[model samples]
Target: MYRYDNYDQTLVDERVTQFRDQMTRYLDGRLGEEEFRPLRLQNGLYIQKYAPMLRIAIPYGMLSSDQLRRLASIARRYDRGYGHFSTRQNLQLNWPAIETVPDILGELAEVQMHAIQTSGNCIRNTTSDQFAGIAADEVEDPRPWCELIRQWSTLHPEFAFLPRKFKIAVTGASSDRAAIQVHDIGLRLWRDDEGEVRVRVLAGGGLGRTPMIGDVVRDDLPWKHLLTYLEACVRVYNQFGRRDNKFKARIKILVKALGIEEFRRRVDAEWEHLKDGPQTLTPAAVEAAKTHFPEPERRPVSDEAIAAYEQQRQEDRALARFVTNNVTDHKVAGYKAVTLSLKRRELAPGDVTSDQMEAVADLAERFSFGEVRVTHEQNLVLSDVPVDQMVALWQALDELGMANPTVGTLNDIICCPGGDFCGLANAVSIPIAQALQERFEDLDFLYDLGPLDLNISGCMNACGHHHVGHIGILGVDKKGEEYYQVSLGGNSTDDASLGKILGPSFYREDVPDVIDKVLKVYVESRHADERFLDTYRRIGIKPFKERVYA
Candidate 1:
């Protein structure tokens, strides 16, 4: 993880002091709610349905054990005892008092963390693959690039007040685990034939009231010009993106209105003067960034240990299922990336208690390398767990209720805090997610269904990224009554696609049954060895829609 230097520390401390003053003024009636709105939003504080919600950024989803402990402390002291990990890979404190947010930010600053840029119409957190450095399929580690972007975008005067929020994701792996296609800017890192690093930049990808898969605006861009090129793209959007309507203010809308070719042309024209400017990256700078993320030391595991793991898998069904679902192959032979699922039966998706956070911190120190990663799927990853210690880690996680063997299953849902916490939500999303989890509690049945993504959002904001789920559920309001809309065939991958609506919205009580019918149709219609996504694509949405609406 990147440690903050004096400059970084001073910046965060100054911002905390500034916000503290702003908050005091607001409370003292020197500033009104309207005046304080932007000030509080810039600090990642939101006035929610019942209380204030504070979103703390976990840059590139990286967290040290110390940071995790600090977060746990903040959750316990400032708000309720639990916090929600969001789709953006940030943590949200749902019950923080408005007056106490500055104190919370002060604590976060002590741990080199902050709530800066986690919300409002500015460049938000820069995210990347959870297994960025450890993934077997990675061509390069995207964290350095993510870090550079984070530094560049944080409080950038040019982009501080964009028409709408901007999100950027980077992926070094061939697999699009970071959902690059659905970000305002998606950087895909790859090497040229001559081994020079390059980026393929995608623009306009976003999910909201209008969902879109980004278009490649620039391909094979030299790594040195990454920042300058990004600046050009954002500049184009800032100048032309609509401000009259919040719905159409996003860069995605601008890209759509102008067409990819024209958008590219405009960005290219903008980049002409800025290509090799002060912000352009250099080899020395890249190397300096890389120094902060040195590779972890590799430890050899004997063949006997591997044999024991295989033997355990053969003997214990539960262990086998856990390995199959929660564990991923690491680039290193002896290590594995283990996902600590936050989704349990009764809890909302991505909700982790303070005690659980502390437990994970301890487990990270004991099993992994004192590091944890928050995934876009609302799970945590211990990216360097040794294979020899897998069984012990599994037991520890199980005891902590974090070892759910439902990763990539329907039960591993990605959901937003919905009407329960978010004032913008039209209906409650957590109950729907819980109901679906209960309806699909059978492990055998879930495994049979195979690799399904079920995501829910309380509204069209797509905070839950429901647009990209295999089964997307969006809460809707019809004549003051809450209803749910269902969509199928959506996926966030190399072949990203927005789901199509099945039909009119269904009542809240009908959602679980509707999903069951859809799955039944899929199971009956799928060919041998076909995954849920493949089956849906092969047969089209008609079969599922017919059964769901029947």
Candidate 2:
């Protein structure tokens, strides 16, 4: 976790004071709604369906236990006694009073957190893989690079008001857990033959009214010029990206119109002057960023401990399933990354109660070095749990209703707040997610299906990232009637691909049946040991579409 310094602390404290004054003016009628719109948006406040929603950024999805406790306290005092974790790894308080938002921000500031850059058409939070440094397959930690970009993009005068919101993701792992390919700017970090760090830059990828997998604009960019090259790309977009239409204003639209080659050429020309400038990263700066993320202390586990874990697994089926689905292999031996499921039945997909949040904070302190991580799929991660304590952690999580054994399964759905909270949504997404979860509550059946990503979005804004799910459900409004559209074969991985629509949209009540039909087709057609995604990729979408529409 990155700690705040004097400069960082002062910056946030000052912003809170500034926003408080601005809000007072708005409430006092000195400022109209139209006049206060941008100011409030930049502070991460949105006027939703019923009340004001406040989105707080969890940078790169990292949080300390103390910070979690503060968030829980804020939720208890300000809003309803719960918070919804978003698909971008941010948290949203849906019922915050407009007048008291400043107080909420002040509380967040005490924990070195704030809502700045969480909204508005500026560079949003830079995200990375939740597994980051501990993932067994990671080449290097991408958090430092994410942090560097965060500092550079925050309140940058040059990019303060882009045509549309910009999102950037970095991944150093062979697996693309960060969904880099679908971001406005995606950086893949790797070492060259001489062992020097480099980046593969992808541009123009997004999912809204139009969905696209980013094109590779720069195949091999030296790590030293990371900031310079990024600046060049943004500069090109800012200058040429559409300003006439909000729907067409994103960088993805610009990349499509100009083509990848021309986009690259323009960026390269801009980079000529910026390369090796003072903004270019030096060894000392990179080292300083790395120091912010020191590795957690570890102790060696004896062979007897491993044997005991294996013995416990054989005796307890639920524990075995929890380990199989919720636990991931860590880079360090005798340790695992455990994902806490927030998608319990009867609740919204990403909603966490205040008590649950406090419980997780305590568990993180006791089991995982007082740190927690939020994943893009709307789950939390205790990234450094020792294998020896796995059983106890599992029991604690189960007691808190966080151990669902459904990570990467059909029941672990990614969903947006939809019409329930967001005014932009045409249909409700949470109920659909809950219906599907209830329909697929059988653990044995889910395990048999194997590693399915079912994502739902209230509308085409794609906040749920439905475009990249194995099975995507998008809410559509046909003459004010709510309908759900289904897509298949989408994925967010090393070989990222956008999902294809199966057919026309279905009625709201019909969506669960439609999903069941799609899964049935997959289970019948799949070869031995094939996942839903693998089966879909192998057999194409025709089989599932035929069954779904039949």
Candidate 3:
């Protein structure tokens, strides 16, 4: 985690004071709703359905144990006893009073966190793979680059307010854990055959109403020019992106309208002016950006440690299941990445109670090296868990109610807080998610079904990333009635694809049964060892749609 320097501390402190004053005026009738709207949005406060929702930034999803403890403290004192981890790798409090948001911001600043640019039409948090620094297959770490973007874009005069909210993601491994292809700007770090680092830049990719897989604008970009090239890309969008209609303001729409070739040409032209300018990332600057990250010390371990872990796995079936589902291989010889399942029957998809938060912090300190990661899939991670301590960590997490071995299963739903909390939502998402969890209680059945992605969003904003789920459910409103729309064969990997909608929307009550029928077709029609997505893509949507609508 990057420690805040003097400049960073000063900037956040000043912003906190400014926002407190702004909030005081607004509450005192000095600032109108229209006048205060942008101010509040810039600070990541939204007047949601039930109360004010304050989104706190967790840059690149990295958090220290101290930060987690602070968050837990705030959650216990301010609003509810829990907070929701969102898809942007941010934590959101759903029930804060409007007047207290400034105080919340102040608390967050004490931990070197803030909510600036987390909302409104500006570049939001720069996200990356949760296992960025520790993934076994990684070629380079993307955190430094993410931090550079954070430093450059925060309060940037040029892009303070774009045509619409923009998102950027980066990944450094062979497998795309960051879901980079669906972001407005996706950067892939790769080392070519010659051993020189190269960046594959993709532009115009986004979900929401107009979902798109980004096009590759530059395939052989050097890492030194990353920021400059990004500037050029955003500069073009800023100049030509649609502002008249909110629906068509995203860069994806602009790229579609202009075509990939023309968009590339414009970006290239813009790059001519900014490519070698002051924004070019120097080697020292790049190294400086990376310096703040803590690297776990590698130590040699005897075969007894390995033997102990294997013996534990053999002894406990539950431990074996948890390892199979939630544990990931690490780059180091004696370490593993463990994901804490937040999708349980008792809670909303990403909601973690303050008690759970503190427990997770404790586990991070005991098992990992005092660092935790917020994943895009709405889970928490201990990235550097020693292999020998896996069983102890699992036991603690199980007691904390976060050791459900549901990772990569249909029951591990990625859902947004829909109509229950969000004003923009057309219908409720938690109930639908809860229905599925109840309907699929058998863990063996889900594991047999294999790596199925089921995501739901309250609206077309795609906050839950429904567009890329293997089975995507979207809420719709027809004459004030809540109806659910289904899509199939969606994927959010290196080979990304937007789901195609099945015929008509069904009533909320019909969703579970419809999905059951769809899964029945998949189970019957799939080849041996064929995943749900593979079967869906192979058979196409006709069978699923026919079964779902029947």
Global lDDT scores for all candidate models: 0.93, 0.93, 0.93
Model 2, span 1-550: residue lDDT tens = 8999999999999999999999999999999988899899989999999999999999999999999999999999998899999878899999999999999999999999999989998999998999999999998799999999999988898987899999999999988999889999999999889988999999999899999999999989999899999999999999999999999999999999999989999999999989999899999999999999999888887789978988998899999999999999999888899999998876898899999999999999999999999999999999999889999999999999999999999999999999998999989999999999889899899999999999999999999989999999999999999999999988988888899999999999999999989889988999999998889889998888778777
Q: Candidate 2: where is the Cα deviation over 4 Å? A: none
What would the per-residue lDDT of candidate 1 be over residues 1-550, giving only the tens digit for each residue? 8999899999999999999999999999999989999989989999999998899999999999999999999999988898899988999999998899999999999999999989888999999999999999999999999999999999999998899999999999989899999999999999999999999999999999999999999889999999999999999998999999999999999999999999999999999989989999999999989988998776898889888888988899999999999999999887899999999866789999999999999999998889999999999999999888999999999999999999999999999999988999999999999898888999999999999999999999989889999999999988898999999889999999999999999999999899999999989999999998999899998888777767
- Runs in model 3 deviating more than 4 A are none
Worst 10 residues of 2 by lDDT: 541-550
Would you list the clashing residue pairs of candidate 2? Answer: none
TM-scores, all models, native as reference? 0.99, 0.99, 0.99
Strongest candidate by lDDT: 1
lDDT of 3 at 450: 92
lDDT of 1 at 393: 98
Error in Å for residue 65 of model 2: 0.4
